[model samples]
Target: MVLRNIMIGIIIIVLVGGIICWTLFSKELREGKNLPLTGVDFKRLADGTYTGTYEGGRFKWRANEVQVTVSSGKVARIALLKSTEGRPSEFTNELYDKVIRSQSLQVDTISGATITSKAYLKAVEDALLKAQK
Candidate 1:
């Protein structure tokens, strides 16, 4: 009976410790939804290719980088330079296309990937900022 009680106590301690660690480690990710994103004016951007990065929030969980090409004062193309996660997913192209088509970072974020979408857009915005005149 004493052995069983000790085992149960150990298990409870492990579970509680895991929960505490998870909460602390994931705090930044949890707060990512509140990340603010702003769009730059295309008319004000000089014609050039600019590279920008989102340092992946405070902890760099989703850090990303992109190259933005502006020609004739409009976004011509955007290429992913680096991603925290290898390989762009299904939503990547759609998000980039939307930015190019609309020329803005105010597009609707991809469902179930809202934080990721914001991170990419933030990187694009960073690139655009460099081109701002």
Candidate 2:
């Protein structure tokens, strides 16, 4: 009987934890989706490197800063300098490739890593916005 009660308590704890996590993550995802993913107008930006940071997502899934290099009025490179995870992941590479290829933040977010992708994009946007001249 004691074992059964312990099992029941464990299940309840798991369920409650799941519910709380879901509520928090769902809210974060909604806010991330609402954030503007507008494309940067590289044409108007000067040729220089710019750094920007954004922390607009859930605590564990946010991009901290992005380093954007613009050259000759084009996006030359993009790098995620910092993130909540403390390092770049495969999603960051994919997102960077898309932005470099398209020269815009209008690229699609990485599947299964939407929040991180958006945070990276937001950081890129912020960096490029500063380069506008």
Candidate 3:
């Protein structure tokens, strides 16, 4: 009986430790400390239609889509087809302007919604690549 109680205590301790570690790691990742951006080649894209996707990783809901259209080697329009609520939706509109005006996905990530910004940028990049192909 004593052994069983010790084992239970150990398990509880381990579980709690794991939860704490995950929480800390997730926060670090969301803050862009643990997560590193692997920049994609956006210049390969030509004038055409593209499909993009963005997943917020652990920060927000996974799965998002963007439709991109390029004209004269520049972004003509960017449409956020789908995204999670909160920051994602708010940033989507802002992204459209930034991308179109800048003609690139290298714009700054949305303030306060960093993860969502990353996801949106990824999705838009994917769409632009699709259009190129």
Which of the numbered candidates is closest to the native, going by highest TM-score?
1
Best by lDDT: 1
Worst 10 residues of 3 by lDDT: 105-114
Q: TM-score of every model?
A: 0.60, 0.53, 0.50
Instruction: Please provide the root mean square deviation of candidate 2 (C-alpha atoms, Å).
Output: 14.0
Encode model 2's per-residue lDDT on 1-133: one tens digit a residue: 9999999999999999999999998998888778786676655789889999887576747657889998877788888877775544788888888877876554445455456777888988997999893
- Which regions in candidate 3 have their CA more than 4 angstroms from the true location? 1-11, 14-17, 20-44, 58-62, 85-90, 104-133
lDDT per residue for candidate 1 within 1-133, as digits (tens), equals: 9999999999999999999889877787677876777777565889899999988766777789999999988888988888985655667778889878877554444455446777888977997998893
Which candidate would rank higher by lDDT, 2 or 3? 2
- Considering lDDT, which of the candidate structures 1 and 3 is the better prediction for this target? 1
- What 10-residue stretch in candidate 1 is worst by lDDT? 105-114
Clashes of each: 0, 0, 6
User: lDDT of all the models against the reference?
Assistant: 0.80, 0.79, 0.73
In the order shown, the candidates' Cα RMSDs to the true structure are 13.2, 14.0, 13.9
Candidates 2 and 3, the one with greater TM-score: 2
Return whichever of 1 and 3 wins on TM-score. Answer: 1
